[model samples]
Target: MIHGCRAIKRADCFHSKGHRNPCRSSSNPYMILFGAVEIAFSQIPDFDQIWWLSIVAAAMSFTYATIGLSLGIAQTVANGGFRGSLTGVSVAAGVSPAQKVWRSLQAFGDISFAYSYAYILIEIQDTIRAPPPSEAAVMKRATMVSVATTTFFYMMCGCLGYAAFGAAAPDNLLTGFGFYEPFWLLDVANAAIVVHLVGAYQVFVQPLFAFVEARAAARWPGSRFLAREVRVGPFALSVFRLTWRTAFVCLTTVAAMLLPFFGDVVGLLGAISFWPLTVYFPVEMYIKQHGVRRWSTRWVCLQTLSAACFLVSVAGAVGSTAGVVGAVKLHRPFSGY
Candidate 1:
């Protein structure tokens, strides 16, 4: 529409040789998503196909997430083994888990999955460090309760999605909520989740940062990098080099995972990885390294409580993994691509 707008200066192109920006990019994915939605609605006569399409899409999503995550885990564990292997195969397979986690989550299948040991470590760093057995016990319980609440919320959201738009998934998923229920309330809920998404993205970034910084520190043991101080043009900057782009990548990756559901991805990922990385690995590693001494009743109780949480979390992960795997196998080839 702006193309036709003129103050009789058509010859004076906006790019008059000094400044030019043919801004073709649209910052809003929701616009593109809704446009396709309008087209789909036009092309279809009714909403009868909603459930079938949903089942297929959801299955595809489920499969991609678990396989991607497990494969990623395999790669991480593999690297932990052959960190210094000399073979070319080792050289080529030496891609670190940091990039892998982001790239894997970016995949359509694993779009909702984000699990890295680094992520887990950052998640429970403070909790794991608590010296008090009771403190650790509370942390474990909190995580359990959080997961349960998130799952229940996602279940409700799934029902809402199914009802509002049938099997039709939208990039702006919450749009359907406005259609099926109260639009105002859905908008508020939607806003709240976007805020939470930002928080979750921070969770992802810490691990990515750690992975990069660890490599840098290894390469430059006594040099100025990562945590070292550095001088800049007008001020000092941390060698960490953390910037808005890094934060954006982390948040956007997570935001992308959430496109089809706007929120279910959070619950799914939380269920799958939150425990394995945070509680299971930390406790097991700590115990294996430090030995779970029967030094004090409090310590014993902490270990026992953590153990119970780990068991339940493992169940959740296994159940989710199976669902994802089975869903992928059941899906028709080329579906949800």
Candidate 2:
């Protein structure tokens, strides 16, 4: 959300002051605004209620992605060919050999972040209604389709973005001033990102809200504060949910304000969650649910895959942590890069 705001502000600034002007924007206001918006949306009863939001988010995602891909293609064509080398950003480009290695490892975390959504798969699956086909079958097919589509877009955006800008590519293609001439289009892309994130924030945090509320309701079954909901126009407002979700949003907002290195934070989270949430637990659950025999070929293969993913995740964590450390050294708290 902060990055989206920055991009929007940059677009406006660049439009008024020309692209060559060094336009700097702070992320504090946007972060607070995002938190406020989320706090209001958090009141929506549960995961099932946010179906429209998820759809809008998906559309916004594709909107920005398509715009970015088109822009990259245009830039590449203008350049007359691909600009990057297979060797990637060279040491001669002022990057040290060790920095190169850390970045390479960090790329794993970014990719992991891109593909990792298993944490919310169960929540999403729960929202699916029963039909002629089983929910499991529907979810399986949906997952496959989503993965294939995501992979295609990732490849296209990544390759084309690299081909266009080479080593000079911005950390964020849309916000990084990679394409400056199409100011209105950039604004639309950034707006789409903000809108997507607005919906996505609720989607991701709904599961967390559910878990906490469920546990609290179980512990204090008789407590009105935890279980009771009051009528408010068309919505039944829960005091407990309101307070808890609002506090969570505020806390996270403050955290974002303090550490605004979006890419580094994303990498760290991806690294931390990819192995356990996405790979290890899912693999174990599948084996347990299906009663796969220990040391059997299928079991061995799954275990091997989990082990390999764990190593990759660890490397990503280390690299991402290093990136965070370097960023912190260069930036003060609440300072937007």
Cα lDDT of candidate 2 equals 0.90
Best candidate according to lDDT: 2
Against the true structure, what is each candidate's TM-score? 0.40, 0.97
Clashing pairs in 1: 50-167, 62-324
Task: Give lDDT tens digits, candidate 1, residues 161-208.
Answer: 334333232323432221222333333434443333333433444444
Give the per-residue lDDT digits (tens) of candidate 2, residues 1-337.
6788889888889989998899987788888899999989999879999999999999999999999999999999999999989999989898999999999889888988987799899999888888768889998999999999989988899989999999998887898888886889999999999999999898899999999999998898899777677888987889898888989999999899899888888998899899999999999999999999999999999999999999999999988999999989988887655
lDDT on C-alpha atoms for all candidate structures: 0.40, 0.90
Q: Residue 243: error of model 2 in Å?
A: 0.8
RMSD of each: 20.5, 1.3
lDDT of 1 at 206: 45
